[model samples]
Target: MKTVKQGDSGEEIAILNNALTQAGYSVKEGMTFTPALRETVVAFQQQRGLEPDGIVGYHTWEALLLGGESEATELADEDFSRGALLLDCETAALRAVQEVESGSRHGFVAPGKPTILFEGHIFWAQLKKRGIDPVQYAAQNGDILYPQWEKGHYRGGLKEYDRLEKARAIDREAADASASWGMFQVMGFNFAACGEKSVASFVAAMQQSARSQLKLFVRFIHQGGMLFALQRKEWATFARLYNGPRYAENRYDVKLAKAYAKYAR
Candidate 1:
């Protein structure tokens, strides 16, 4: 749909007004967009963690329609609370890690698909573990199979799934295990620690909703013995365990600390 802002008028405006009203935002009658409606929209956007531009767009419409339930890609406040309770940490810690790991508040790049980063180095190891020579595939698909981790390889966004599909053709289980999935960026190889019987199950859960992702994160942290570090707000220790020893290179610890402070208020 085209952008709807102040002065626009039509069936769409009527629908937007109705949705805003349903979402508990005050809206005036009729189909014309007015300054009052714009203010209400901006307030709604801010409360929903959306870009508060006072323009009704795809994301704003989606938020208004969803009305705080069944947002598969987003997390509710209660999800964080339950996860924090499980980890014996403040909800702020969980929020901090989530923001740092996913690079934003969202866990999914698209509906039914959680954000993912396919690791070529991990794929090499996974193939080797499964006794399939990565060398055979390396010559043809160097981007998806490499002997060591390097920077600047990520395709980012939906394109990462294309890389994952290539790796999956070689070995489904190994491909699933090579990527980090969802808000927590939990490596799929840690599926067992995340309380999944198989990598496929882990991937399925990751795609389901943010709540499922949080559940997996809680399990992964608790089972991997990282919960205590998180509870104590040991940014360095938590970042090292969660993001690897190279966490300092990207300043994940500092980022986590900052994010935590922002959420903790």
Candidate 2:
């Protein structure tokens, strides 16, 4: 919880306040960790027989996450339903994909946000659209945000927060599309394809939980016209459309084939 206390600020503080409110405590509308927030924390801690330190530590996090039934269990059910509906596959396929992609559904980049792999192709497109010289950008950023992966020192599935932030500086829409989001790593630019209104909404949905991540992924597959490929176990077609035209060289289809075989067994 980032060691929340009075005078602290930002989204984490705001989230803590919201959790307190959901647990039947009052909180002001904002991100600031005020004196009242401390009081509320102490009260909650006291009720749970914890030291009234007025700080959100590990114990507080446990209480907040598991207080009223487990969100994890609920999210898992949603993920399975959504995956089955969209991909026409069972949980095994989905689990295998998750295992290959992010190691786990909870492999978060930030609190409540899934890790992402930034796309150089999307960055080039965004830069060209803005009339910005991508070559010049690559020259300055050292390929960390461009077509050449090595220039960025990226070694597959690395967290690209700096790259994403740079893209956001250029354009939010492009930034959203430039990074693959969630357990499925669906590109953010696919927000509309995923049935989202904007990048912000897509990011918020991505931050909601793994269930929402899976839902977003299903929508992406459906909108991209790749659902049939997955349904028929045509990993070549699915990987090509979903991963890009270079999926063959990347062996994404082969990987998906092996993952599915492991799960289908």
Candidate 1 on 1-265: residue-level lDDT in tens?
3479999998878877877777887778888999998999999999999899999875565455433545557787866764564455798998999989986657989898899999999999998998999998999998999998886679999999999999998899999999999988999999999879999999998888877787778778878978789989999999999888888999999999999999999
RMSD to the hidden true structure, all candidates: 14.0, 14.2
- TM-score per candidate, in order? 0.72, 0.64
Q: Compared with the true structure, what per-residue lDDT tens digits does model 2 show for residues 9-29?
A: 888787787778878988788
Q: Number of the top candidate by lDDT?
A: 1
Q: Which ten contiguous residues of candidate 1 have the minimum total lDDT? A: 62-71
Superposition error at 92 for model 1 (Å)? 0.9
Which residue pairs collide, candidate 1? Answer: none
Evaluated at residue 37, the lDDT of candidate 1 is 88
Model 1, global lDDT: 0.84
Clash totals for all models, in order?
0, 2
